[model samples]
Target: MEIVPIDTPSLGDRSYVVHDGEVAFVVDPQRDIDRVLAVLRDRGARLTDVFETHVHNDYVTGGLALARATGAAYHVNAADPVSFERSPVKAGDLVEAGEAMRVRAVATPGHTFTHLVYLVESAGEPPAVFTGGSLLYGSVGRPDLLGSEHTRELAHAQYASANRLAAELPEETWVFPTHGFGSFCASAPSAASSSTIWRERQLNPVLTRSEQSYVDEPFDAYPAYYDHVAQLNLAGPGAPDLSFPRRAGTTELRRRIVAGEWVVDLRHRAAFAAGHVTGTLNFGIDGEFATYLGWLLPWGTPVTLLGETREQVARAQRELARIGIDRPAAAATGRPGTWTAGPISSFPTARFADLARAWQHRPVAIVDVRRDQEWRAEHVAGAVHIPLHELPGRLGEVPGGEAWVHCNSGYRSSIGASLLAAAGRRVVTVDDLFERAAPAGLDVVSRQVMA
Candidate 1:
């Protein structure tokens, strides 16, 4: 028996293909089904089943599409109100995928009200359970994705679910989870790349801590795009339309920028800060491109991608499609000068030391665009905490003056600086690590270590 993990690192989730020899089953695939198909082809295994642990809130699922393409049985929760046809599965149901592989659905409703974990048993290999968005490596799936009203109830249920898994599964059982690899779906960050049921029982907070203590986990804002993903999944998203958009020219790019549509530059932060088409936002294809772009772009707003090469734009399109941002309005690939006849806008990039030096000379409003947990952990003293997601709505709150934006690292701050620049604010992006702030002689403050 071989279990192959297909990772979508941008969304911080993993889908699994478990095969005995000739037949296989998949768990929680992303919207792009080609990757899964490639795995099946390489393994020389026919896909017999596709399973969804839950209706995901981070990215569109490709389970429906993959099943249709391969003639595999699409397995979804019996309780889920999905529009499309699926082999509805409930707790304790046993399913066979070829002669040698067996799957048992175990109800674990912490991540979502109808979440399930699949325990797969093969001829000789030890059992492995795919715990999607429930019991992660060292943490548990965040229960707040549904909303505040159900958060506490789900949190308690999550604790029960973790304990139940620990009590039922053997110590030798291998555990694989869909979340907690930097996914917002997890309640906390998990450092381990792999773990076993025994290790999780000994280390995971949900299993080790009291139910009350686990339920008290506080949550900050998640991506704004997350609000739409669950609905898209329930509606049965099909294969992504990934064909290249019409090649746009200088005139079309300018028109889109003037009309207030999103014109995203997919380049390095340094390249973007050096020079970019005026009014275009930098989502840097090298960074968390999809997560931030989907989070910041207003839902259904037309977007035009600007990249140095056609491949860069194509890469950005693939990432966007995972989060259900199907097609770009148009795309342009070339130098900034070629992108527009108008003057290209440029912003200054600085380091923490430069920020310290600048602070000694003039009044600068330091805008920290990290999440609340990051803010409370430690931040430069006197920095205004406006998370990147909230920056668009709360621009008026940033005090007037030359603004210096910084995140834990430079990725988010570059984004924040670009937004401020578009709003006509004088801004400098602190394009260095935040750890350098205190060493560079900036006053640093911390409320408490993040829980």
Candidate 2:
């Protein structure tokens, strides 16, 4: 038996290819199906089944596409009522692959009401489980995805479902989860691709916590387009051609940058800050670049890139393509003076302690770039609240001073700081202000007074 995990960096999603001898099955396939087909062909395995652990909210799945291409049976949870060419898989439903591999559907509906986890039972080895959004490495899926009321019910169900799995599965059985550390599906770091049930039983915080705490803990905020992306996934996405634009020379790249076209520097943050095309947004190609790009930039915006090299640019293009944002007009060659105008500057970063001390001496304005809910919940004393999305238009509201900026995390702060700095305001980012402020009792400033 062979299990291959395919990590799609753009969406922070993982797809699986499980095969035994001549038969193969794919689980939660992303929009790219050719790679899966190529792998199966290389191994001389016949594609037999494509399974969707749950309907995704981040990227489109290729279940239907792979089914149409290879004439394999497509399976989705029976309770979902999803409108696709899928065979409804309920609890106890069995799927066989050749003479050696078998899968049993277990209804696990905490992430969504219709989610399922597959229990893989091979001919001679211990059974392994594929827990989709229901169970993750460190955290469980946010129950609030379906709405507050439904979330409560789902949370209870999820806790019960998890308990059921823990009891039924053996300690040594390998657990292959759908999403890991970097994925927005769960807050836990998905650095490890797979883990054993024993490890999760011992280390997974959410799984060990009481049911009430598991449900009530504040899950991180999701991007605004999550529902829209979910609809796309349910509808299924067509295969992308994956053919991006040719890399242009330094002059042409600079010309495009001058014409107000956005250049996304996909290099590491340090490499980008050291030297990048002027006015380029440094959304490092590491974590959730595609998701953030959709939030930060307008849809259908013409974009060039500053990758480590031409090959890196091509990889970045593929990452962008997963989210249906594939307009790679050109690539910058990292030549100095190529981009001469349009905010040739970088945002400043500072420690929260330093900003707090500076605030005591002078009237330095603090800009909280977190979401409206988060701002209302807790923010720094005397800080002006402007959500990152609304900051571009409300710049005039920001009082001129040595500005200090912060978000729930540093990503939005960097973006906000960049824009403010570009507009000629001195800016400094407060790294880890939320964690620091909360314990110090400085986070709970009066909202009424601020308003």
> Which predicted model would earn the best TM-score?
1
- Please give the lDDT score for candidate 2: 0.75
Model 1: how far residue 21 lies from native, Å: 2.0
Candidate 1 Cα misplacement greater than 4 A, ranges: 448-451
Maximum-lDDT candidate: 1
Each model's lDDT comes to 0.92, 0.75
What clash pairs does model 2 have? 180-190, 181-189, 181-190
Q: Write model 1 residue lDDT over 1-451, tens digit each, in one string.
A: 8999998888788999988779999999999999999999999999999999999999999999999999999999999999999999999999998999999999999889999999998877889999999889999898999999999999988889989999999998999999888788988877788899999988887787778877886887888899799999999999999999999999999999899999999999999999988788999999889999999888999999999998999999999999999999999998899998989899999999999999989899999999988888898888899999989999999999899999988999999999989888889999999889999999988675333
Question: Which runs of model 2 end up more than 4 angstroms from their true locations?
Answer: 78-83, 190-193, 246-263, 271-279, 298-308, 326-333, 339-343, 346-363, 368-397, 406-412, 422-424, 428-451
Candidate 2 lDDT, 108-172, residue by residue in tens: 88888888899998877878888888778766666677667787798888888877787779988
Residue range with the least summed lDDT across 10 consecutive positions in model 1: 442-451
Q: Candidate 1: global Cα-lDDT?
A: 0.92
